[model samples]
Target: MTSTTERPEVEPARGGTHASGEPADDLLARHRAVAPSWTSLYYEEPLELVSGSGNRVTDSRGRTYLDFFGGILTNMVGYDLPALREAVTKQISRGVVHTSTLYLLRSQVELAEKIARLSKIPDAKVFLTSSGTEANEAALLLAMTYRRSNQVLALRNSYHGRSFATVGITGNRSWSASSFSPLQTTYLQGGYRFRSSFRGMDDDAYVDACVADLRELLAVATAGDVACLIAEPVQGVGGFAVPPDRLLGAYKEVLDETGTLFISDEVQTGWGRTGETFFGIEASGVVPDMLTFAKGLAGGYAIGGVVARGDVMDCLDANGISTFGGNPVATVAANAVLDHVLDHDLQHNAARLGALLKDGLGAAAQRLDLVAEVRGKGLMIGLELVGADGYAPHPAAAAAVLEQARAGGLLIGKGGLHGNVIRIAPPLTLTEDEAREGLGVLLTALEAVDAAQG
Candidate 1:
């Protein structure tokens, strides 16, 4: 890496203006100087996106790329959306902007109502937080208290968050910060069959085996006093690994008898990203006891929350609050996002365009041996890269295609248990033309990697 003062030689961005502007690396160098070493960034040469509109973002170097990853699936509708900006600015303009949840906030209440209606949890009660990690922590607080148990269940290859408690439950060791957790967490088999014991089984058989395994684990591993079973319907950071249909429903069957709560972490798969339904868990045919949401919920706002029934949510016999959770501006922004998503029927857009993209990528996997699997639904898709033998994970190939896609004016994401899965999740407002353009660039990138690595 170049020292902070050394300006590396740079190349111009294609189809970009002012490409020779002051070195874009300066900001990154400054960030490295102050930010924690563990705070990671994307790409070989880190990109500083200065502005965005619709489904694209322009870097400080003046290069633009179709934003397929949507800022890790946070920019739901797109960047610089007029409606969201207006609502947020209007909220900001109103007086002191007092945000602590200690006081009653009309905007916060309204947003909670919308989420309660949308979350699909029976008799849902909402609690807002600043991020998905905190939202999940809140869920854990409720579940563990309600059930009077600290034992929790999660899936293999899962990633909940980096917070202390969440890190304990996270099965993806790559994202774990520490091994210690207050809650007793157990890992169960899910639909990420590539690295699973039920790899070759059909969907029905796979679900059966996983459910059986879970029952046995709970019996042998614990005293049958589990608090909750939390999962991502579509494993987002785990490379968009979609569990088999009815898998969660089957697990819910066992949890029902054990009095164990079910929490669906929708941080990455919420807001129509999966296309099949509004919430990713809806497709699984199991209504969760609690749902944790963040990322794209309020467009680009830093907001997340949990929803559960009144009895479960009120189990804590103490008062609590968040300094910024459900703040006026973010909540109003989320209300606007909900309005936009509902009025424009953007979920249908995600369905239509997402289907097109998935079909195209599926076709690419047909002839490309490097692509071991094409899984996930709608816009939340994954391409699992493999080595020459077509089974071992090829993280190098994933990295090469990521760089190639950036060069081709497309920005995507990479994640998996082994970092070999290419994640594709675009904005819900993406047009058909934009969708086709991004698909073309991705296909070209895949072809380039296939030729070099196959």
Candidate 2:
């Protein structure tokens, strides 16, 4: 591990120049002196963010930049939305700042009802938690408790959460290693067309291969004791990686035959961010026994997560109760977020804007040799950067591109097991005009990175 002092701090441009002068050296020094190095892993920007508004953030130097990252794709409605602020303020005025989910909370019930109605799940039940991790944690516990089986099978590259149970089920060994204990769970490799060993196989053959691998894993790894099979409709952190359409159907069929419940972890893609109804699952016409959501639901106002499914939810009682799961204030904020998203038709916006973004990125990939593929659905997009000499993750190139994007007034994220893919998942409310501007900035960043390499 590199020490903070050894970290290279990029200097902002000189004052009076378009970009802020090199980042303040003292600022970076102080961060090294005070903050832990782990937090620095999120970004390597020079300027410190001071405040933010809709789609724009102001740095400490008074220079503003467009926020394309959207707080790692959590702020679906942009930063500090008026309605979200008002909702939070009004709830704070009511004096129920933080209360356990012991008794009835009106906002909690109301938000739950709204989510249930919007989910189109007929009679879905909602369980609120503080973060996506907690939500996934709750879902994992419920699946294990309900089925009376401890073994759960997850995809090879899927990212669930970091909590003990969720981490055990998460396939990414790097981030999930600390929480890796001997849990009654196993991981089966999922389909990734970009790097599949069975690349030359047709779609039908690929689907058959996935089914066969899953059945073998279940028999050997789980000892035929698997309770649930959890997967993301579109793997978010693993890469903006979208699995083959037939893979979902085939996996569902295999799980059905094995009597293992299916769980969809939509924590990142849920709440209309991925267009097609709720998420990619709806597009494939597969209904999971349990669904998890979080990221865009509350629009970055406060953390909120939900698990929807009537029959499956009925399996757990006090075993899954959260102390501060459904606080009134957070619930009120969530209620307003749902109201705004539905009333403004954000799902339709997500679909339209996502197409615009996908087209832009795909065209860029075709024209640029550095780009390997443009994959993902709706607003959730990824651009894979091939290695300088090989197809592995070009971390230095990825870092350079990220810095260039930040300097050019756009923010993007990096993901994939190799951290080679640049992730672009903005708010569902992002306009076409904003998409164009962000894409332009992104293109400029890529050009600059290539130039730097030259």
The model with the greatest lDDT is 1
Per-residue error for 320 in candidate 1, Å, reads 0.6
- The CA lDDT at 163 in model 2 is 71
For model 1, the run of ten residues with the poorest summed lDDT: 10-19
Q: What is the lDDT of residue 7 in candidate 2?
A: 69
lDDT of 2 at 402: 88
TM-score of 2: 0.90
Using TM-score, give the best candidate's number: 1
The clash tally of candidate 2 reads 7
- Give model 1 RMSD, 1 decimal: 5.1
lDDT of each: 0.89, 0.77
Q: Once superposed on the true structure, which residue ranges of model 1 sit more than 4 Å away at CA?
A: 1-25
Model 2, 1-454: lDDT tens digits are 8757676866543434222454334566667777876555445646677678887888776778777777888888888888989998988997878878777889898888877776666568988888888888777777877778888888888898877778888887656757555467777667456776766678788778878988777767776657788888898888877777778777888888756788888888887887867666776678777777887777775565655578778887665466777787778778888888888988888888888889988888776767888887888888888865536667677878888888787878888877778889887778788899999999988877766665
